[model samples]
Target: MNRYMWIIVALSISPLSAIALSPEEKGLEIAKEMNRRDDGFGDFTATLEMTLKNKQGEESVRVVRNRTLEVPEDGDKSLIIFENPKVVKGTAFLSFTHKVENDDQWLFLPALKRVKRISSSNKSGSFMGSEFAYEDITSQEVEKYSYRWLRDEDYEGKPAYVVELDPVDPKSGYTRQLVWYDQKEYIPLKVDYYDRKNDLLKTLRYEGYRQYAEKHWRADRMTMINHQTGKETLLNWKEYRFKTGLSDSDFNKNSLKRAR
Candidate 1:
């Protein structure tokens, strides 16, 4: 009966062993799992309606089209073109994100007939007079932040994992972000961004997530609210088409001029 007792003891300890991971390790594991679940969409195209609301409740809207290409060895590449609004029409932005290095970005102005490079120092600034900063528009790689698992809690009636992400980039505008990841899908439901002064700056919420290709999840709408300025940006995405056979040639700086 000694062997039987040993087996029982082993089973009891296994559960405890699984729960003994340090906060950092557990946080990293969660981030990696989330990244793994989203690994294989070759490319996608979508239409976006961006609404900017000021503190006085005045609103302005812009129509944009977005194309993204996945890079297995590095971060993704994306190009965004403005489609509507007489003022911003024919404007385009291109970004090449890297896992370890600063991202390369450029903006093409149709009126000016020039392409302006976006410097790393200016990434934290506003994007197109919206609440979203330029850096916030880039794909967030798993390696870009250090994470700590805060706790498990209920968020909006669903069980969620609360995790704190400290930006690895020194130039980041946020000191830390508290993220609420849906426990079931491993997708982010909400995030609270703290500014460099460690004060609450903005809150972003994802809504109406729908699965694509039976494996990938995308949010239909995202709202970002700036507490400091009382300004908000709403991104409404539609017509998501995945695996559109996009290539690197479609995401270069030169392509920005031809985006329209």
Candidate 2:
């Protein structure tokens, strides 16, 4: 190759290729890249066993079914229905998440035979009395948070990107979140949530990741531990069925009432 061609090749392979990206720009790029990889599953269904543990270590478990439909221009739409626990049986939650705005959520109570809208201000509240806040359960749209790349580090024996994300919404429960994203898979392995007081509030860890369709990564287990309360929540996911012909109608408020 000629001298010019050699210079082009060297630039392409050099670390300086990324010199133009600021920390914020690099963080957004990473976030968008990860979102792109997770974009095309279309829809999926899964079974989840949620275990809630108190500070004293007492545990209670509930079984639920989850359905999610993709919305390309915005975030995803999801429906979750309780199945096993008698108290929560037939109860359902439906969420429509958006990229630049607050999410729309509703809960259906079988006993009351009514669907109650979840206020935007309540997004920080506990979801079903678990460690996961209502906002935590919603899709983590890239536009929902502003990000800054902290550093690259080793986490769980793997190279990971440490990024800090601050929620754009003033009403959000968390002041910021620090995520450890697996460098290879572009998947989040752990997240530390800070409360409005800027104190560490909860830590969430994702484990047992198994890929599907040769590209999509799904975590079989997710655990969240609350620092102040000493409580925790474990979610065991199973039977993930992707592209199951789910539709937008399957995620509406009426669907919540009709959810099985």
Candidate 3:
């Protein structure tokens, strides 16, 4: 009789424990989950490969190294190192974000021994030759965009929640974004970007997910395809370590000038 009672208790709690969540609920939950550690401060290392195809059916490849560190209430601090080929080897670019003003960016030239400031408009442009624009490399600020539940669906054989986001800031690079999140894990499966004219500009697909830590799932591989430019960028996470004890001073404007 006690065994039978235990079975009933398990059945009662199962349904309540795995309640199906709404789309917005899933997206927000996953966003919050990814940032749950170190107060959103950590270090990530990845190999970024950019493939640019021209209308003439020619393609060029550029390999890069990407590192990012984020701190709460502060914008994303990042460094992108160019590691391939003889000419651009050891070249590094850094960006320091501001609380109110625009981000300060700089590029260190190995031959020139000088760091040049990056203009705002160029930041929205491509990084190296990849389809992933420079704007996409920085960490996304959740509050800058408002979210709404779109629908529930199945993605890659897993339950998914679809949500749409409208950029609250007028100066945002993109007007709207649609995200698909895994229902079970709360990880983003796919995201769509729409331009200011409300047209689909690019489609980004996330794959090769691996657990970075407890309750934290990181996408190890991402492919970004540019429909307009016929180019693509593939990002492979070589090393993604969390809670590295990175300080704010490591991400200041002075660091940008000394990037390489």
TM agreement with the true structure for every prediction = 0.91, 0.91, 0.76
Per-residue lDDT of 250 in model 1: 90
Local distance difference test values of all predictions, in order: 0.90, 0.90, 0.70
> How far in Å is the alpha carbon of 101 misplaced in model 3?
4.4
Could you give candidate 1's per-residue lDDT for residues 1-260 as a string of tens digits? 69999998788665235657789977887898898889998899999999999989999998999999999989999999998787788999888899989888888988888999977567689887899997787888999999999999999999999999999989999999999999999999999999999999999999999999888999999999999999999999999999998999999877888897
How many Å off is the CA of 166 in candidate 2?
A: 0.7
What would you estimate as the lDDT of candidate 1? Answer: 0.90
Query: Which pairs clash inside model 1?
Result: none
- RMSD in angstroms between candidate 1 and the native structure over all alpha carbons: 3.9
